[model samples]
Target: MFNTPGNSKGDFLEQTKAAREERALEKRRDAAAALIQANVRGWLGRLKFSQTILNDIDEIIPDVLDDTDKLHYKPATEIYHQALKFLFVWKKERDKERFAKLCRYLVASLDSDCPNIVMLVYL
Candidate 1:
């Protein structure tokens, strides 16, 4: 009987095991990369959404704070929601001082039971 070159059973088994391990390691790396990508995308999406909200708040703050009625009786509920959104965005941005100052301004602006005061405390 003659043995074929490099065809020993032990060598073949070792090659098969190595191939399987390599494939498994590659799969694990791919999965980890994908998970990291997903987390980054989610974080970016949330940041963008918060930025949009913050911009909207900025545009309307002067008018609301000045009570110029530019929005002309723009329901208290809507104003309340805007205030809440502003606080959330500020909190996320770690600007607690600004938020606190804004709250004080809002309270001060309520010189005479401004409907905004009720709106602020409503919830």
Candidate 2:
């Protein structure tokens, strides 16, 4: 029980049994703590800024893909087209308003002549 040497065999056996029980209880406590953490908001407040980051990524992807699509290589253009298709659907489902805003922003700048219409048509 105490830090001193045990005089009785029964005392030593009891201490070992208690130690094992303590270890098992500690493991249970840790598992419960992790489950509680999974239910909590998070240290960083739900990471709401992640939505903005997603929007930012959405805003730039089309221009990058368009540039790649211009490169004339068959495989590269096909892959770029595939990525564009995926992003378009994802943005629509996740942040449709932001998608519309970005589409307008891109279009508003290029609405002058038929030349720009060609670009819009490609998109």
By lDDT, the best candidate is 1
Model 1 lDDT tens row, 8-116? 8778989999999999999999999999999999999999988888777665544344553332343456656887887776673566644664565455444544564
lDDT of each: 0.66, 0.52
User: What is candidate 2's lDDT per residue for 42-113, written digit by digit as tens?
Assistant: 744535545445545454444423333342222333334433554544544666755564454344435334
- TM for every model, in the order presented, reads 0.65, 0.41
Q: Where is model 1 more than 4 Å wrong at Cα? A: 1-7, 63-73, 92-123
Which clashing pairs does model 2 show? none
Any runs in candidate 2 off by more than 4 Å, and if so which? 1-8, 31-46, 54-91, 112-123
Residue 28 lDDT (model 1): 100
lDDT of 1 at 27: 100
Q: In model 1, state the lDDT of residue 88.
A: 70
